[model samples]
Target: MGIVNVTPDSFSDGGRYTDVDAAVEHGMALRRAGADIVDIGGESTRPGAERVDAATETTRVVPVITALAAAGVPISIDTTRATVAAAALEAGATVINDVSGGLADPAMAGVARDAGCPWVLMHWRGHSRDMNKLAVYHDVVAEVRAELLERVDDAVGAGVDPRQIILDPGLGFAKNAEHNWQLTRRLDVFVDLGFPVLFAASRKTYLGRLLADAEGRPRPVDEREAATLATSVLAVAAGAWGVRVHDVRSTADALAVWRASGSPRLKTREN
Candidate 1:
């Protein structure tokens, strides 16, 4: 999966693709670079970010999704709102990548059920505005797995097909640096839940902190690609079904190398 943030305030590559034409072209470029799916997100979910209205988000993503879909790119709407997801699906998105895992909007499950497309349920404790305060966890890996299971139950109970469900640990949302590392270190815990797991640690703050300077300053977003690539390769080795990344080509190349190294069987089912 490749990220296309059509917002002005995302932590990484925000204003770069806010224009409709630019965003669509970027999606196409990602497709050419080997992304299996192009994820289009209108809102900036960076920590402490405020929510955008549904109308605005829908406006930002529909045109881009429509154009990309027309050009034969697989698209996923990265939104927490059911209305926005429905609108994007209508515009041609084939997947729903809801970061809130259906907790933000109750209608999201119904939308996923009706669409019968893949639904990515990410582990989220709260909205971006207050998520930092909710990072408390005695055992990050166990808690995240249990919470994701609850979300799985919710989706199944809402008439959604279990086979269409995907899980994400939500690296930054409601998670501290240690929490993010713990989830990645024990990614198999989520993969063991019998659902495809999406590891999306691309250009995240946690990675930035990991590569911090001696002055205690976090590394810049663009500089985190190396760390992101390392995480992607390691996550796949740990049995992640897919990885969401900013530099799709680099990650794809790395995965190709991993595959060439014998394409060994991983812990979880390969998609």
Candidate 2:
């Protein structure tokens, strides 16, 4: 998957493609770059960011989503708001990438159920405004893993099919740097949920903290390509189903090379 943020304030590459034409073009480019899905986000869920109104978010994402869906790209609407998800799906998004895991808007589970689209429910404690304060976790891995299972229960109870659900461990949402590394090291914990796991660590600040350049300075988002590829390959090795990213072609190429070394060993379910 490749990420296209229509908001003006996403942590990475925001405002660069807020316009529909640019976003649509970028979305198409991702498809050409080997993205199985294109994820569109109109709201900036970057920690500490303020919320965007429904109408604005809808306007930013709907047109681009409509264009991509028309052009035959599988689109995922990145949102936690039911209203936004509904509008995006109606505009032709096939998936819901809800960072809040149905915690931000209680009604999102129903929306996903009715849409019948695959949903990506990320583990989150609270809204962005106060989520950082809620990062307290005793045994972060176990706590997050159990909480994510509870979210699966809630989503299923609200009518979403368990089969259509995927889970993400909300990295950088409420996690401290240490917690983020620990989760990455123990990604298998999330995968054991019996659903596909979408590991989205593209240009995340935690990566910068983990890896630093020659000067002992962490690379900026744009300069973190090598780090991203490192994590991507690691995640795939650990059995991640998919990874959301902004640099589609590089990761795709990197994974291809990694798999070619022993493609048969990579997961390919056979009947």
Candidate 3:
């Protein structure tokens, strides 16, 4: 998966693609660079970010999704609102990458079920505004797994097909740096949950902090590609089904190398 933030305030590459033309071109470029899915998000879910109204969100992403879909590029709508998801689907997006894991909107599950497309349920505690305050976890790995499973159950109980569910640990949504690292280190646990896991540690603040300078300033977003690439390769090695990344070419190239190395099968639950 490749990320295309159509909002003006996403933590990384925000204003760069707000224009429909630029967003579509970028999605096509990512596809050419080997992105299996181009994820377009209209709202900025970055920590401390405020929510955008459904109308604004719809207006921002539908045009880009429609243009990209017209170009034959696979598209995923990265949104939590059911209305937005429905519009994006009608506009040609084939997947729903809900960071709220179906918790934000009561109608999201129904939209997903009716659409019958893949739904990415990311582990989340609350909305971005207060997520940082909710990042209290005793055992990050187990808690994230349990929470994600609950989301899976919610999705399933809402009449969604279990086979269409995908899980994401939500690296920075409500996690501290250490929590992020713990989740990444134990991603195999998520993979073993009998659902395809999506590892999306692309240029996250945790990676920036991990690679901070001696002065304690975090590494810039663009400079975290190397660290992001490492996470992608390691996630694949740990049996993650996919990775959401900013730089499609580098990650695609690295995974290609791993495949050339005879990517060994990792243990996973027999769902």
Candidate 4:
């Protein structure tokens, strides 16, 4: 999956594709770069980012999704609001990538059921503005898995098709650097849950901290592509269903190399 942030304040590559035409072109570029799906988000879910009204988010993302879908690109609406998801689906989006994991809106599950499309349930404790304060975990892996299962149960109970649900560990949403690495290291556990797992660690702050400079300063966002590629390769190797990334071509190249090295397990498969 490739990311297309149509908001002005996403942590990485925000404001670069807010225009409908630019966003459509970028989505096409991602498709050309070998992305199976292009996820477009109108709201900035970056840590400490403020929320956008539902109408504004719908306005920002609908036209882009419509254009991309019209051009034959697979599109996922990256939003938590049911109204926004409904509008994007009406505009031709095929998937809903809800970072709130059905917790933010009571109507999200119904929307997914009505649309009959895949819904990505990311592990989230709260909204972005106050999410950092909710990052408490004793055993990060165990807790995340358990929480994700709870989400699954809730979504299933809410009438979402079990087969259409995908799980995302939501790296850096409310997690600290340690928690992020811990989740990455234990990715297989999430994969073992019998649901498609989406690893979205593209250019996040945790990677920057991991690749800190000699002076201990975190690496810049653009400089984190190497780390992001490494994470994508490792995630694929660990049986993750997919990875949501900003730099699609580099990740595609890395995956090709990994497969060419004769690792049958690294062959891409749908989860």
Candidate 5:
């Protein structure tokens, strides 16, 4: 998946694609670069970010989704609200990537089931406003895995087919820098839930912290492309079914190199 943030405040490359035409053009570019899906977001869920009203979000995303659908590009609506998902699916989005994991809005799972489209459920605690305080975790891997498993059950209970569901570990969302690192370290844990895993660490602050110089100042999001690509390659090697990223061409190219080697199961460093 390639990311197209149609909001002014997404953590990375937010304002670059906010324009409708530009968003469509960027989606096409990503498709050409080998993105299996283009995820378009109208709301910025970055930590402490404000929420955009449903109408505003719908307005921002619909045009782009409609254009991309017409262009025959697979599109996923990255939203937590059921209303937005419904609107986007009707507008031609084929998938719903909900960071809230069916928590933010009660009506989302139903929407996904009704649409009969694939849904990507991300592990989430609270909304971005107070999520930092909620980042506390014990045995981060087991806890996240267990929580996501429960979410899978909930989604199934809500009539979402288990087969149509994909799980994401919710990187950078409700996770501290250290927690994010732990999740990265245990990226394969989510795959045990018997669902495909979507790894979305593109330009997150964790990468910035990892690549910081001795001065300890974090690198800017835009300056973390190398780290981002490296992390994506690592995640793919760790059994990720998909990766959500801002730089599609580079990631696509990197994955191509891995694919040419037969893209078999990833071996651990120890192996």
Candidate 6:
């Protein structure tokens, strides 16, 4: 999956693709770069980011999704609002990657159920504005797995098809750098849940912190692609179904090399 943030305040690549034409072209570029799915998000969920109105989000993403769909590209609506998901699906999105895991909007499950589309349920503690304060966790891995399972139960109970459900650990959403690394190291715990897991650690702050300079300053966003690629390769090697990345081509190339290396453990199941 490749990320297309059509907002002005996303942590990375925000204003870069806010224009409709630019967003659509970037989605096409991602497709050419070997992204299996293009995830279009209108709202900025970066920590401490303010919320955009539903209408605004819908307006920002629908046209881009429509244009991409018209071009026969696989599109995923990255939103927590059911209304936005509904509009994007009507515009040609076949997947809903909800960061709130159905907790943000009560109607999200119904939208996914009715559309029969894949829904990505990410582990989220709260909205981005105050998410950083909610990162406190005892056992990060076990807690995240249990919380994700609870989300799965809720989504299933709400009539979403279990087969269409995908789980995301939501690295850097409300997690500290240590928590993020722990989740990455124990990805199999999520994969073992019998649902396809999406590892979205692309250009996240935690990666930058991990690759901090000698002075302890975090690496810049553009400079973190190497760390992102490492995370993608390791995540896939550990059985992640897919990775949401900013540098799709580099990650794709790395995955191709891993596959060509003839590692049986890298074999993945179709979703």
What is candidate 3's lDDT per residue for 125-172, written digit by digit as tens?
A: 999999999999988888888898899888899999999999999999
lDDT of 2 by residue, 138-188 (tens): 899999898889999999999899999998998888898888888888887
- Please count the clashing residue pairs in each candidate, in the order shown: 0, 0, 0, 0, 0, 0
TM-score per candidate: 0.97, 0.94, 0.97, 0.96, 0.96, 0.97
- The TM-score between candidate 3 and the true structure equals 0.97
Which residue pairs in model 5 clash with each other? Answer: none
For TM-score, candidate 3 versus 5, the one ahead is 3
Once fitted onto the true fold, the runs of candidate 6 whose alpha carbons sit more than 4 angstroms away are: 266-271
Q: What tens digits encode model 1's per-residue C-alpha lDDT throughout 168-261? A: 9999989999998888878877878888999999999988888999999999999999999999998998888999999999999999999999
Per-residue lDDT of model 6, residues 1-271, tens digit only: 9999999998888899999999999999999999999999999999999999999999999999999999999999999999999999999999999999999998999999999999999999999999999999999999999999999999899898999999999999889999998888888888988999999999999878888999999999989998899889989998989999998899999999999998766434334
Steric clash pairs (candidate 1): none
Q: Report, for every candidate in turn, its global Cα lDDT versus the true structure.
A: 0.94, 0.89, 0.93, 0.92, 0.89, 0.93
Cα lDDT over the full model 5:
0.89
